[model samples]
Target chain A: MSRKLNFYAGPSVLPVEVLEELQANIVDYQGNGFSLIEASHRGKVYDKVHNEAIALIKELMGISDDYSVIFLGGGATLQFSMVPMNFLVDGKVGDYTLTGTWAKKAYTDAEKIGKVHAVFDGKDKNYTTLPEASSVKPSANSAYLHLTSNETIGGLEWKHWPETGDVPLIADMSSDILSRPVPVDKFAMIYAGAQKNLGPAGATIAIIRNDLLERCGDHLTAYLNYKTHTKSNALYNTPPVFSIWGIKLVLEWIKKTGGAEAMAKRAEKKSALLYGTMAESNGFYRCPVDEKYRSTMNVVFRLPNEELEAKFLKESEEAGMLGLKGHRSVGGCRASIYNSLPEDAVSTLAQFMKEFQRKNG
Target chain B: MSRKLNFYAGPSVLPVEVLEELQANIVDYQGNGFSLIEASHRGKVYDKVHNEAIALIKELMGISDDYSVIFLGGGATLQFSMVPMNFLVDGKVGDYTLTGTWAKKAYTDAEKIGKVHAVFDGKDKNYTTLPEASSVKPSANSAYLHLTSNETIGGLEWKHWPETGDVPLIADMSSDILSRPVPVDKFAMIYAGAQKNLGPAGATIAIIRNDLLERCGDHLTAYLNYKTHTKSNALYNTPPVFSIWGIKLVLEWIKKTGGAEAMAKRAEKKSALLYGTMAESNGFYRCPVDEKYRSTMNVVFRLPNEELEAKFLKESEEAGMLGLKGHRSVGGCRASIYNSLPEDAVSTLAQFMKEFQRKNG
Candidate 1:
């Protein structure tokens, strides 16, 4: 069966090569007589898979020795609570920028845990805009400045990172991680759920600076604490084995296909196709995001009316495209073209969008 | 290559049928044009998989509407903290049974959260024996009584449950879930990591009685809160999609092969074969676990000496048996015959055990 152009916002697209490799090894991993899923995490078989996944992430992003790379479960949403629970101690506040849906969620969850101040809230602008990276300032007693590098739902992304000297900077890069070369040294930590650019939906990858590990409080529970993971190298408990295994394959695919630099170029080319189509369409396809903050990962757009959008979705799926429907909260369209989404899928979608607009118009 | 007898503790053996289905669907799920791993959790494809997994658990376990079975990540280790955080309120003590390593870990984590009482401490017995169910009692002000239904490392299991009339009973059944019929109404909650009898390592299944969820505080962060999962049907955040998907398939297999009743008979037959082999070995093979409380899932034993035990593991691996070596914490041998482990594997191991003792004795 031919594969569909998967544009759904995460558990999004993965390279066909990775999926095929996963199929090949699903039952017998390297003729070990058992699937890696069944192997003990402590055993040599899984140890290689686990370490290679971490090493690949570090190599791809150029992470330094000062940083520790770890894989976890519970997705990036758990990180929302864990970040503040570990870092946002008494007498220090967590500074957050509510640029879009994901940023607001991180801020909301942080507020429940401890003292959190929103440095910039885009709610008033209907989450279509982002605060200029240099314009936002953290509080005096800020423990960490938190931001969502890309918002999947709102289609706004941080093209430039915030400058917080002496204050730790943390970003939930769940949607856009490894899509491009990241300045790993600039942030204290960056975490992404593996469903998007990494692998499948079970594992979450976090890169933490060694200094930030000291901030993890003793009061935190074992799994909730970052220190526990760092100590055990994320083998604190039985990891999401299959998920991490998938990530390793996907990472290998990325590395073989020219690493993060090539991913960035592909992301640019893919997003440009859609955005460029909108530009040439004479206002038929409208992107709600600010031009500068438009996400290269999730390109969310809308038609002239709700009826046309519904028609577009119906026609797209009939044309063998899936997940073009926008988030239910904000109705329109979304094409999440992550790292593993082929350039051809984007080209096909671009062609589909043009044909849909022509027939509907 | 023929499959070996897999016995590595958690992340242990899964049904060959389930693995085959996983391999077949790894690239394109049921000709859906995209792998389920790459499908959105909120989409119909994954929503069906998630709901079916929950429904199957409810059906197999005879769970009533009074309970909510939700899937979460971070394994059962996270549940160790979550149980006390949600249920162990102020002015109430969480009653615990330190039956083995897992129980102790749960108790230790709970201690950091709130006041906890060890109703039955098995440390004096070196975690080889379990307290009689009727003999154990919860404190008057106890909010809930927690027990480890099966200890994977120590090869100890609870044959009967502690009766706490008014207080809720919670059990970490990570290693022994679905191996036999369980009285769902007796316990307020039961959670298991899905690497053992269920499926794989990424997902943790929690069966919580409805009343317990109400104890979840509003101050708790979204992912940490039980109410957040129950309200959204475990869709509050992105779930471990592939793990849960694997679980649904396993559950279906369990159902088709005559449900919990058949699993119980198979487990009894398999475990008896190993224990009988030890009993007939005349001190050559010794099981430290008290016979009355011997675990059906993890059958751990020791040979005459450390040298023989090492030789046994080496020969077993060479003879196409894997994971026969015990956990690093305990230097012996363990054959984890989980629900998916074939009866023939146990028979072969029993024959090998007799031959090894005859030669070495």
Candidate 2:
């Protein structure tokens, strides 16, 4: 059977090489006598994998000693709560820019812990574009400024980061991390769900600055405390061994296929091809997100009408292009061409989009 | 290559059938056009898996409608905090039994959240035996009474559950959840890390009664609150998809091999054989845990001396018996025989034990 082109957002798509390698070693990892999943986190095999996953993140992002890269569970959603619970202490306000559903969710989580100040909310504009950097003015006593670097549902992304001088910046890069070269030093903390650009759905990566560790709450549980994890090297509990190992392999693949810079170039090509097709469709296809803020990771567009949208989805699915259907909240079409999505898959979608438009128009 | 007789504490042995099935479908899950890991948690494929996993737990344990089986992350450690955070509210004391390392750890986590009362302590006896059921009496105003059903490191298992009427009973059943039949209704909530007797190391299974969930605090974070997770069907976030899917397969295997009853019978036979062998060894093999409270899942023992113990471990590892060494805190040897550990593996270990005694006794 032929491989289908997967375009699902967050639990998006992984490189075939990573999957093949994982499949080959699923039972016995390099003849270690047990599957990576079955290996104890405290043991040598899994310890190597755990450390290597961290090392890869550091190497790929050019991360310095000021930060600690941790592989956590419960996805980025857990981090949404954990970040605030740890940092937003003693009535310190967590300043947030509401770019999409996720940013708003993070704000909700922050409200549970302490004071929250919405620096800017894009929902008034139907979340069609990110807030300008000039418009973000956080409170003087704010603990940190938070934003969603990319909106999976709204298909909006920050072309440039908002300025939050002296207020340690935090970003939920769940849907777009590692897809391109990120300015790691600009943010005090950044987290991403591994399902998107990393490996699978079990692990979430948190790259936190060392000074942020000092801001953790006194009453935080051991598992919830970022400092506990940082001190224990993320072996505070038996970590998601298989998920972390999968990440190590994926990171190795990333290094082999040139670094983050190379990934950025590939993403640009795929996004440009898909977006260019939509732009030239003569009102046949419409992208709701503002052109400047359109996500390179998730390309959201619409056909002429609901009938055409239905027909397009059915036909594309038949042609083995899965997850092309848009998020239910934003009903249209979404071609989530994440980092691992080959250029050929984007090319196929672009060609199909034009052909379908010609027939329907 | 021959498969090693793996016996590590956690992230331990899985059924060979489950491993083989996972390896085959690591890339494409049941020809769903994408891997189980690559599928979106919101998609139909994952939705089916999420529901089925909950159903399987209920079926195997004979759980009633009053309970909700939740797939969570961060392992049982998170539950240690979550249980207290959710239940120990409004100045209510969390009553705990300090039975082993895990139990102490749970107590530590609870202290972070609210008032904790230690009903019983086992460290006086080197954690060799669980407290007598009759001796465990919680405070009348206790919110809940917590204990570890099986101590993986201490090699102790509760022969009878402590009576804690009205105050909800909670247990960390991490080491031996599905290894034998359990009185599900007796405990208001039970949680286990899914590395032993279930699946891999990413997902955690929490079987919580609805009444218990109603007791959750209003101030809890959305992800940390049991009410939030139960209301969302554990879809409060993107779940550990691969781990949950593996659990579905494991539960199916458990049912196919005759459910929890058959597992209990098998555990009895395996434990009897190993323990009986030790008993007949004329002080050659000494088990530290009291025979009445000895664990069928993790059997801890020692040889005549440390030198002999060292030699025994080396020889055993060379003969393909891994993880025979005991935990660092508790010196000597530990043989963890979970549900998936075949009778032959234990028999092989029993035979090896006798032979080693003959050589060096």
Candidate 3:
């Protein structure tokens, strides 16, 4: 199979090994006589897969028993609402940091739910910068301090996490989850849409400190309550079975390939290659985001002009590369080199960037 | 490959053809260089898939422009809350019929959301029977009348839909959707989890009459509001990409096999085979569900005693059968013959039932 270099932002590339394994077992999972997709979620076949996925995430991320790692449906966008619905209760205000697009969305959704405060609004800087982790503070009555670890659209990532003493620190890590060694003890909760660094699109992974689940009030509907998922081990409903199975396989791939530390190193190396190439270009390419807040996952940059950007995208597609066009909101180019995207693909792109500049610059 | 006859309930059997197609394209979709799962949800590759899935559902269900067919995540359990959160506004009460475990769960969730009333409760009959569709009536101020089209646990199904003239009629057809044709105009909304007749888990298909969107309030969170999905055509968030693609394949298979009418005939034939076997067994086997309400999708029967039931389950597995054990709530044998389950599998199960009785008796 002639597989192109995929650079899509959120539903980005996955390890070839994971895809091969999924392709091999899509029909009959380990000779259990039926595809895992068609097997009952409560049955032993899928139950094992479900638990293994949770276990691997815990082991890979070094999470403790004090936290519950639950998988839910509806991407990180759902978490934008559920995070506030479950926590912004009992007269507690939600403290949010508007670092970029996704964090702003979480804040906006929370405003519709209850009282919320934005501790740091990056909108003044057009979301091209971030607040100092040590400088940001939550309000006294804040239930939780929320932030997005990385903005896929704005191509900004937090280099360090904020310290929120008593108020729980919650993060939407959809774009950069599993791409680094995170200090799990520092945060009360972390959520991610699996399409980015985990596996596929159907599942959302949430790691909630056990204490936070107690705050999930009875007023919330069953599915909306985090307690329901934690109580049933995310089996309160028929889970995204096929998606979870795919996740289990991807997690296994992660473990076999030297775990989270290896992934972090790969991320640094891949992002540096693209950035280094841009640094060499003489005013031909420019990255809009502040260099300190530059994302390791999604590297957004611009060519000399809109015409060159259009030509670059078309040529990239013809040259066996895809998903190079930036989001419409940000009119430029983006290469999302998530955990599964090989460094070689970035090198290929970097080489292409130089060649394109030579011809046009 | 030693594939066995599978009889799982939800997340149950799927057509071999669908499985093969998925297996073939799990890595490189249509030679697009990357798997569809890896492609961006907003891009052309997945957009075509997303829209085609919606279009096919509209065509197969004979739905018109008046209805907005949308796919969402979090299953029917999420819908339980969303239905009330969106519709049970402005002092309108939701009328629910308590039929079985699933129906009761829906009712209980709505209770937390707003004022609700049980229009026709089958609890008096221990959920072994259903209310006659014509006999059931909604309260005057009812915003909508809700019913479970088929109960996967109790093995009961509504033979005819309730006629609620002014009040919107809604049905959760998670277990038996697409198994037969229905009058599309009768219900204001119909939602089903894709695990059963539609495809795999992760995607929930909702066909809502356009007017229902008007009732979705601004008070609700973005993901919680049905209007958000309708306005963006279910692309409000990064959708469950792989699951929707599978649903599209399953829909195509359904169309090729002969639409819903053909499926109805097959359901009757397959269900009759199992029921006929029980009838021939005389005092050896019993079906607890009322004959009129017996589910064609899930054929549940009890052996003469618990010991025989255990023996039947063990021997069924040894004879290359799987998922024959009933749900834990009710201890018996249940063979879920969903649309994708071949007639040959049912014929074999019937043959096994007869031979088991001959040997055990």
Candidate 4:
């Protein structure tokens, strides 16, 4: 059977080099006559894997002493609840900016545990435009100001994070993290699930500022507590060993292949190619999100009608252009071009889109 | 360099066959000409992988229509809190039996949510024995009775699970699930972290009785809610994709080699051989747990003194036997012979144990 191109929004692309290393060790790792999957997470080999995962994250992101990175279980969803459960206390409201579905989920979870305040809602405009960061009214004494850096559902990106100052600026960077250069100094915490750009979806990465670490309220479960993870270096019980190991490999890939800067450049080039093709289709293809808020990763666009959209998806699938269907909420097609997506795949997708539009018109 | 024999407890071992399949997918998966790691979670390929995972779990365990299986994030530790949050309501008490570290953690979480009646504590016997089922007295109109089927830390295994009759019997089978034949009909819910014997640490399998579907208590976060996962078939959120994929491969390996019955028989053989070897060493090697409660998966033992134990561990490491060190509380060595551990590894370890004893003696 021939290899197939995968275009999943997440649990998406990975570097070939990393996968090859994994493949070689999958059956028997380290010449131990046993597969790496069968290897011990606590042994010397995995200790190196675990330690290097943290180190690599730091090295690539240029994380400093003020920031500590921990590999946690649960997808980005768990952090939606955990971030507030720990940090939101002292009766101060938790400020939220609703840019997309994921950020709203994060806000709703905070509502259950703390006083929540929404700065703006992109929903009013049907999420076609990002909430203006300058217009956000962050509370003076709020526990934290939260935002979704990239709204995967809406194809909205925060070109600049709102300035929350001492009031911890928290981000759910699940989709856009590591896609570009993120200034660690700007936020108290940045968390991302290892699906898009990073690796497979087995673990999450939380980079937290040292000061915010001490503010977790009393009711935090030890497993969900960042302090506990930091204390044990994220080995607070049996961790997701293989997932972390994969992440370690990925961070290494990111570092070896010219860091986040190189990835940001590649993402720009690939997504630009696809979006530019859509723009060239005129009225046949119209992107929903405002140009200023357009995501460099997820290029979501719509056709003349639902039938045409369906036809495009079907034809794309036939041609092996996968995961082009938009999220159900958005009702269009989204081409998520994360970091590991090769430039050639985007070119192929763009060519298909152009041909389809010409014939349909 | 030759690969060292690994024997860590959880995130321990995987069948060699699964690893080979994983390796083949590294560069190009199913002739897709792309790495499996880069494949989309929602694509045709991974969709099949997801269904295959669910089918394998259900088929192997002989699960029926009355139960629904869910693959969740956060490992067992998150479930420790989530179970109580979603199931244990206000004014209701949940029954708990404290067998080891895991059960104790569950009990601790339950305390945060509702009144908990701890029926039995293995701490009295230093966690090496099970508290008899007859000794348990449930709270009136209890939510459910929770027990740890196998305690990894204390090397404790229950020969028979206590019958809860009409009440739900929730078991944390994290360590020894699927190692032997289990009556799927006996429990209302069973949760296991897939590290010890399953495949990897990132994925957790939960089997819930159908009747418990409508009983989600109020106040729990929607993402933390069990009903949400059941309705979406564990794809409510971005699941641990690779872990699920690997688990599917592991399940296939199990089925192709022989089903759970065969796995049980193999477990029995390895345990018996290791026990036999330990016995032949006279007073030099002694397992802490009583004979009747001995685990077929993890075997914990000790030397006469701490110095001798240290010497044994060093010699074992030199002989390529890694992760023989036990828990900090136990202060000895533990050999966790999970499903993927070949009997030959046990034999090799046994040979080393005798050699070390001979040299010291």
Candidate 5:
């Protein structure tokens, strides 16, 4: 299989070149006579890696001095627990928008640690659209507002940042980070799991407000302590070393691929191509998400039945296109065009979908 | 830089062959288009990876139904807190032998949850020998006895597993897990951070006696709950996917190289070669530890003065002998000859030491 197009939501696609770089260095790194993983995280070499990873996130997002970038473990799900644990001080609450599964997960876990106010949930509307900004009632005393910028499961996204006044906005940008140009200063904190747009599944990138870190609770364990990690800059413990290395290569890949602007343009073109194909797919293929809120990173659509979806997935797999099955929340197909999925792969997928519709419809 | 040896303790050297296999699959795995890291942990592909990783540990260890294996996040240090969290009940205490830094860490953290009996320490002797087993005073109702079988620091190791009567032995075999053969049924538990013998740093391998898991607290989080992982066979949460993948490859390498017996024989040969060279240098190069307890993995030695030690380290680095600096507790040169270090790397280091001694001594 020359280029097996992987459209899996996350633990998604990463560039073949990055892995080759890893392959070259897995036994020895940069003439160091040691695997990168074996090098000390506390040493100068790893210090550069950590600093560069943070710098790259900021560079890509074009963030300011006010925000501190943190690379972390536990993926985005851990952030679900961490956000409440850290930010929700005594008597404070967090306003969460339930856009889809990820938002719901973040909100539900938040309720266990602190008070949670559900601003708006598209759950009632079968999660087909994003919650309107007019309905979000940000409490004056709320610690912060948390939302998912792109809901991969529901194929919804916030086209515009919400107005939260003094209440800082936090966004889980796991699915769409770096896929387009995102305003760095709009959110108090933003986290994206690496599998989607960055590199692999073991690391998560966190862009956080420096001052907000002061409010993090001291009661948690050292490993779970955001304050401890924030204090030491994510070196409080032995980090996932190899995964961070992969992310470093991936960040370089992003820079070479023309930064965020070029990526955004390519992503828009790719999503437009796939969605256009789905639109012309007639009664055979249907997209459940509202057009305005559809995610540029993940294009979700459905066939008439599971059997047809199964056939589509199977035939697509045989035709060298895999991970085309949609998430369980939406029963169809989701072609996740993350940063690593070149525009050609997306076009190939679109071509395959078009041909499939031509034969089956 | 060709075939440079890795000496970064935990994320240290992996078998060179695993790197070759990893290169072939980085962008496309087994004809699957997407890179291995891009695959979902929830998907069947990763499930195969997870199974094979655990299966390899069992196969390599030659364990039976008495022991169950699981991979966890946060490395071995997390297990320092987690072992107590899961196994510490209202009335029970645990015994720990402070052989080196890791065991002391394990013992110190276990005290937070319950009672601890520190069996022995070589602090008085400046960690020159393994703490004598005769010094161990096992508690009548101790949950288990914990020991760092191979201490990467201080160059100490339990030459053999200690018998603690009715009390079960729990070993942190992080630096020595596939380096030697062991009777898996003898221990109540054995946990190793993958960076050393297994694969990468993200995953921790825990081999627990099935009956011991029943003692784990019921209220533990699903993520940290041993019972939760043991029941599902370590699929409790989205585990460290890439680490597990690498572990599978490492295990296959170990198998292809004739399993742990071959590994143990190779370790002895490499370590003996290095240690023999140290002995031949007499007072010029001094090994600080008792010869009987000297580790087969970490060979620690000192020069006549701090200047010579510094020069030795610097010149060694220039000569491609990396990670030779000793742990802070015992300041000197440390040559960590883990399973992945080919016999020639050790021979090269030994040759370098002799040449340096002839010129500098």
Candidate 6:
């Protein structure tokens, strides 16, 4: 069967190969008499899948033994709470860069736990750009610096990261993780919800440096405390067995298809093709985010009016394209082409965009 | 291909029909040209699935309009903390009945958030029996009474619920949800990890009465806040979409196969056959749990010696019967016969038991 062009922001597309693999193993995993979902997380079958998933992340990202790769549930929203619950103590300030919707929400979530400082705010520019790296700085004696590496809502991403020096750096890399090469050692911790650039929802991956485990407080509940997860290897209580297995397969696919470096090259090509078309649209179609900080994963653009935007979405859906509607918080159009999205699909979308402009411009 | 008789305690068996249905749609859900896991949670497809799952739970359990069914991630361990975070506030005593390992863990988790009272402790009896209904009582000013409906560890189940009077009652029904008929209105709230009788191991079902939403605290993080989840219909964040879809299928299966009433009858028969065989052994096999309170879900038993117990597990696995090994906390034989366990499998287990005893007697 022919697949639809999936651009829906997340619970988004997965590699066709990954989906096929999951299909093959859905009933019985490797001739095991039971389904993978029926297998115990503590059992031998899942232990291998769990370990391989962790190993693949380490290998693909060039991560050293300094980090522990963990699979968790509750998506990036839970991580928004956990990062502060673990690192931000009563006496320490947690520095945050408010780049877009997710970063702002993360900053808000942290406020419920302890003191947090928004060191930089991009909302002043309607979340169209990132903070200048030179002006960004963690507060004196701050517990950690937090930022969203990519914001799906406004189609914004940080082209350059801030230098936190001695302070630990944390990022909500939910949209951008595994889409390109990342320097694992530069940041103290990183987390991503698995729906984008990975496998599916249900699982969130956390890559935390070993030293950060010390900052986990006593008042936190067992599941809320990162130390409990780290110590138990993310199996403290049945760590989303099926989703972790799905992640393992997606990670293996990532490794086999030439690691993060290869993904970076692919992203550069895919984004350039789509962005070039938008750039040449002669203001018929306009991108909202700044050119330097535009997200390669989610491309946001707008037509002349809401009526035309509505027409664009209707025409695109009829042509077998899906999830092109922009985030409700910031409406217009968003074509989120994640790692699993083929380059040809984006080219098709660009061609469609030009045609739509000719008819509606 | 023949399926294995899965008897593992939590992350346990699902219906073979459910597995086949999942396999059929693993790649293209209803020929939509995309995997269900790849569908957007906010999209219409997932919205239908999300609503159907909640509706099925309410219908099957005979739940009234007063209760709301919410799906959350991070297993029942998260609920252990969330129960207290929402309801166990300061100046109010949260009463707990320590029936088994999980109940003890729930009590420990609640202590991290607020004042809790252990109304009854079963550890004195090695967690082999539930407190008598007459002997158990909640505090006069208790906020809510919490208990484990079924304990997977020692195979103890509450034969009669404690009288909490006007105070709210909460239960962690992780291992035995949908295995029997439950009076939903009798409890203020119920939460179950979805690895057992439900579907898979990522999503958890939270059935909270409308009034329970008021107990959610303001200081709690967004994901931890019950009110936040209830207000948004559990879509405050991108939910564990695939797991929730799987749950919808399982609940559909339960409804089609004569609902929870039929499941209760099946449990009764399966548990009787296993326990009766143990009873007829005449000291050859000894069940650890008290006769009256022995769980219909998990049947924990011991042989004359550890040597025979090892032999039992080895031979059982070789004979295509798996997960007979009891929990490590209590070293004995355990056969968990959940709702999906076929009657023939239990008969096969019984046959194995009789033959093993005859050879070793």
| Interface Cα RMSD in Å, per prediction | 0.7, 1.1, 0.9, 2.6, 2.5, 1.0
Task: Highest DockQ: give the candidate number.
Answer: 1
Writing each residue's lDDT as its tens digit, candidate 2 over A12-31 gives 78888899999999888899
**Candidate 4 displacement at residue A247 in angstroms:** 2.3
State residue B236's C-alpha deviation in candidate 3, in Å: 1.2
Model 4, total clashes: 11
Best lDDT among the predictions, by candidate number: 1
Report the lDDT tens digits of candidate 1 across residue range B94-158: 99999888998999899999998999898887889999999999999999999999999999988
Docking class of 5: acceptable
Tens-digit lDDT track for model 3 on B81-195?
Answer: 9999999888889999999999989999999989999987887788899988899999989999999999998999999987899899999999999899989899999999999
Residue B44 deviation, candidate 6, in Å? 0.8
Clashing pairs in 5: A4-B33, A11-B38, A34-B6, A38-B8, A38-B11, B10-B195
Q: Give the runs in model 3 whose Cα sits over 4 Å from its true position.
A: none
Candidate 3: residue A177 lDDT (0-100): 89
How does the DockQ of candidate 4 come out?
A: 0.61
Query: Between prediction 5 and prediction 6, which has the larger DockQ?
Result: 6
**On residues A1-361, what C-alpha lDDT tens digit does candidate 3 reach at each position?**
8889999887888899999899999998888778999888888888999999999999999999999999999888899899989999988899999987889889999999889999999988999999999999999999899999999999999999988898899999999989999999999999999998999889999999999888888998999999999999999999998778888888998898889899989989999999889999987989988999899999999998999999999999899898899998878999999888888899999999999999999
| Model 5 stretches with alpha carbons more than 4 Å out | A23-47, A89-91, A111-117, A138-143, A165-168, A280-283, A328-330, B42-46, B91-94, B107-123, B134-144, B162-169, B215-219, B231-239, B328-330
- For candidate 6, write residues B1-361 as lDDT tens digits: 7788888987888888888898899889889988889999888888898999998888998899998889999889999888988898768999999888899889988898889999988878888778887777889889899989999887988867777778888989998999888877889999999988898889999999998788787888888898888889899998888788888999898888889989989999999999999889998999988899999999999999999999999999998998999988788889999888889999999999999999997
TM-score of each: 0.99, 0.98, 0.99, 0.95, 0.90, 0.99
Order the candidate numbers by DockQ, best to worst. Answer: 1, 3, 6, 2, 4, 5
